[model samples]
Target: MKLSQLLEYDPIIVQCHDNPDADAIASGYAIYEYFKEHSKNVRFVYSGRNAIQKSNLLLLINYLKIGDVLEHIEEWKDDEFEGLVVTVDCQYGAGNVTRIPAKYVAIIDHHQKEIENVELSEIVSGLGSCSTLVWRMLREEGFDLDDIKINTALYFGLYTDTNSLSEINNPFDKDMRDMIAYEKSVIIILRNSNFSLDELEIAGNAMKNYLYYPKNRFAVIKAKQCDPNILGLISDFLLQVAEVDEAIVYNEWPGGFKYSVRTCVKEVHADELASFIAEGIGSGGGHIEKAGGFIRRDLYEAKFKDLDTEEFFRTRIDEYFDTFEVIYASEYEADISKMELYAKKKIHQGFVIAKDILPIGTPVIVRTLEGDIETEVSDDLVFMIGIKGEVYTNHREKFERSYQMTDIEYLSDDELLKPEYLPTVHSRNDGSVIDLSKHAHVCISSGATQICACQIDKRVKIFTKWYTETYMAGKPGDYLAVRTDDPHDVYIVERDIFFRTYEKME
Candidate 1:
């Protein structure tokens, strides 16, 4: 939708996320300016259990002159004032943001993951910062930027959200940075803003008591209680260690523990690690390089009862490595042609093939990402097969060089059956037939009534109806009788029948 279309709703309200940060405030303020310029009634609002508490965030709000413009959500009386609500920076109804009720709601955010119920949203992930998105929107609408305060706010929002432009990976973030002009001294001051006294003490103690895993270059620390931001700070500080490639810091709260993770290693994704730690315990996810999550205390206690928290975290890290191996090992690109063949019929493909059956003269297709080869089975082959049934003496060496047997999988007979294609029961009344041609031998239970066979003698048949008479193996009802021949060959094989036939011929 166009920018001007936002004014179609009366008394429009632009709302930022809970515990509003510089980015949220800046983005909401930008939207507020656009709607206000068009003479539409708009109010910038935020709602949370606590107001803006961080010193740097408070400073940014004052510096940007957003204190009067932004109001607490509780201050607005729904009965007195009602309009279309617009969520900025953070998505509406997300875990981080408090939900607000409105007749019609629109969302403008930069978070990658989104929830439903958003009818109008301009969400763009990987933009580094939501301020960049808002800045782009303001520019696209030809909004005047005579107010330097707005520019400074947007710049600060972009700077802090992307960690002083160090985390900016997209063109839009850089474009917004270059477009906005700001004083270098202000940026230096903002960057140098020190952590609180409590935060400093927490980080210091965490680093001093951290556990170092040299094999994976992972560092872990647990604290009794600390500010959530301190975990992130300590996690970053842990990466400064020469031997550390990844850092994890967690702190206990009422009924759960919040964790912050950071990784400089390209192969280790902090987001994935956070989720791994919280799997079956709690919720966790964030950026690739920096991520944080929470785990319920009950889950932690169940594993760490009568043990130290440090040892518990160490075990968790080991579990993470084990899970990582299993999850990441099979994440490589698959052969599209082999995948198509596997989908069409549950037979040999990329990693799966018939375990023991190598039908002579039948075409066998082996495929890998590099390419695929078609070969026909030959009778004389031993641990090697012909490309097209031709005798190749060096087949083993050639095949080994072309294919890695370790990567290919040989499947068993039980693995090839498609559940949907299998008959529920073998019966003529239901028009259902059981398939048995794939098996060399068949076993029938005494309780089984409806009988069907796919192979009769040396001929292959589709599900043909058959019958059998019950016979004891040893004693009465000792075991079910096994049939060797159904075409009366047993009588010919008897000694009496053979002797009588010979006598008649004589």
Candidate 2:
């Protein structure tokens, strides 16, 4: 429904999502500005005060004089207030907000669908930020923009929600362009806001506490009493760490635990991971690259209390990494000799032979549809095999066996193997099939492939015919270059080499 239609009633209650983020706060303020301009009485209400990372958000609140609403609310006699209630940046009765009475008039948000009993609801995931939607509404209603406070709040909302415009895509192009054009000053304000040394210290400490599982290509970090906004900051930091495909941070709060998961690999979505982890436990949801969820503190502590603090967090973090395994569309065992011949001929011609052919200690490059990634050779990578002609490193044993390459499809520039599509490979030695798909692609450093082979799961056997004969001076566990499918690149082997190397050469 149109804002005009919804605002036909006077004295409205404007509420944002609980723990109001920048987008929610900005959207709330923008709506308040729109209504106040039309000479309507609106009071903004929220549950759970904002935290430290969102302190800059308060600047907008003060600048826009949203403090006036709080003042009016103080004067309001509970019985004296009678008006339609409208919620922005949140669904009616969502976990993010307190339960509103049946009097909810309208809802505006950028989240997925939720059970909201409001009379009017507009939830669009297409919008990059909820504030963008609010901005559009104000413009549509011809609200004045001369109010610096309103503009500042909206700008901060847009900046924080979109990660400084990093999350926006073509779908939000127009909205982003307009926001950028109109709110240039607001952007400057956000940049100048004091993020505070304490916040940075907390984030750094969280990183230091991260536990990495080489076999899974994932990491996890846990802490007590951290700002929710720091979750986003942590995710961004972990993505840049070498060899980390995905990372998660679980923060303990007074009443519950919140989890934030981030991925540089395209195959997995953060929201899906959050949902998977939250299943049969608490609540969680988010987008593909970034997602979050919450678990009641009592339940979380009860289930994980016996586990070592580091171990518990790491185990939970590794659970979802198994889903990223690389699986072939079909299974087959091609002759190793034929594959070797192809690689040898290609290598002789100065074409980087894209094959599973690095020795335990040979350094190699790993290239995927998204981009090139690198890691050092470790003990658990022996069972991973690249496609006959394809090269990449991973920890799982499922991708080792020969597989038939049928249809070839291209993924987006940033797309990687999704966890669901990974195929499991059975080991020929013990009649046991290991799922190697979990470690679909990897890079390894030079001179560490041999030591890496010893770390493979006991059930899988490693074949080494495809390894290069050259040996450089380095320890067995030293990093090595592993070949990948891309003809122009090589990757550092991060785990076991036996699985990644196919024997047919020596």
Candidate 3:
């Protein structure tokens, strides 16, 4: 339903989810503004156990001028209030949201859950954030958000919900971000605010005790009781490891298992992985790179009394690896401290060492949809000899055996670097820098390819506009010459080397 139809009720009460986040609060505020402009009496209120605890939220509330308008649900006196209740960023009776007992007018939410007893409900599951839904409503009514604070608030809500716009999958979310010129300075500040001291401690402990499984190149951690947001933070931290392409961090809460999955590897999509892991046991879904969900442990146990819950999760993840198809799986000695230091160093450098460089003239194969093409190793660059005979080369990190090419094969001394191989043109087209950074770490639709470079083991560099001087890098599927957020920057690599490699794997 549109705002015009919802505004028919006077003195409408806007209910937000309990323990509201930026999306929840900003959504309620947007509705309040729309109704207030139309000369309707509306109050934005939320009911929850904790007040806004995140420091960034405190800053957002003050900077966006939303403090005075939002009210605690307890502040409302039933005798003095009379109007239909409208919920935003939450469903009427969802466990995470507060349910108001009164005449219900409407429900506007972005989550996949459904609710009952709502007359006017606008539930669009594809939206990255509920704020996007509210923004659409107000903008549709010919309302201009001339207020800088409101615009910033709306933008902040969407940015955080979508993980700095990294999680957005729909045009609606993208359009909402583009609707107004949001203050990037504020966003950078806000993005760093969600983590609390307690949460940081949890992350530190989780990382310290992390279980690094070499068999699958995964970092798994179990934390004490913590906020759902903390899981995301920890998962992001784990992905920084060079060996760990995917990170799965979770905690057991009162209800069930709350988990967050993150990946910088080109062959693993966190959203799909989460869904696959939670299948038949609980509910899970999210964006391609970043996603999360919960599994009702009680319900799962009821259905599978003979299975261990933790084992169930692990087995599912292994199944996903087999199905997704990756290049080669080599075992590594589990090294927690080494990974910790590597993860720490990458933040400063913006890149990490991808693989050991092979000696010059060492033979390696770059897998393609058509077939594997052979090439020589490079010390400082990734080289791909096209089937039609075009040679592609870039900075060393751009070439990873698991992500950029195929397995390393020994060639006799008589075999030369220039084997008589056909150089067919790569099927994938080139992309600008912005397109590259947006998909930098997510899994490719196809399996990863292991590209061989020099024989020396060294640190791999990752560069962006402000990062290292090098521009292009390799992703999972296929393609070369990717541009990032900086218009001037670009990453070049060969395509289809890893794409569909799983199907061709022996």
Which candidate has the top score in lDDT?
3
Ranking by lDDT: 3, 1, 2
Q: Model 1 shows how many backbone clashes?
A: 0
Candidate 2: residue 110 Cα off by (Å): 0.9
The runs of at least 3 residues in candidate 1 whose Cα sits more than 4 Å from the true structure, single-residue gaps closed, are 72-82, 223-227, 279-282, 295-315, 326-506
| Alpha-carbon shift of residue 166 in model 2 (angstroms) | 2.1
lDDT-wise, the better of 1 and 2 is 1
Question: Please, what is the TM-score per model?
Answer: 0.59, 0.59, 0.54
Task: Give the poorly placed runs of model 3, Cα more than 4 Å off.
Answer: 39-49, 65-85, 90-102, 111-119, 166-185, 214-216, 263-269, 275-282, 297-312, 319-506
Please say which candidate is ahead in TM-score: 1 or 3: 1
lDDT of 2: 0.54
- Arrange candidates by TM-score, highest first: which order? 2, 1, 3
TM-score of 3: 0.54
Candidate 3, after superposition: displacement of residue 495 in Å? Answer: 35
How does residue 6 of candidate 3 score in lDDT?
A: 77
User: Relative to the unseen true structure, what is the C-alpha lDDT of residue 97 in candidate 1, on a scale of 0 to 100?
Assistant: 60
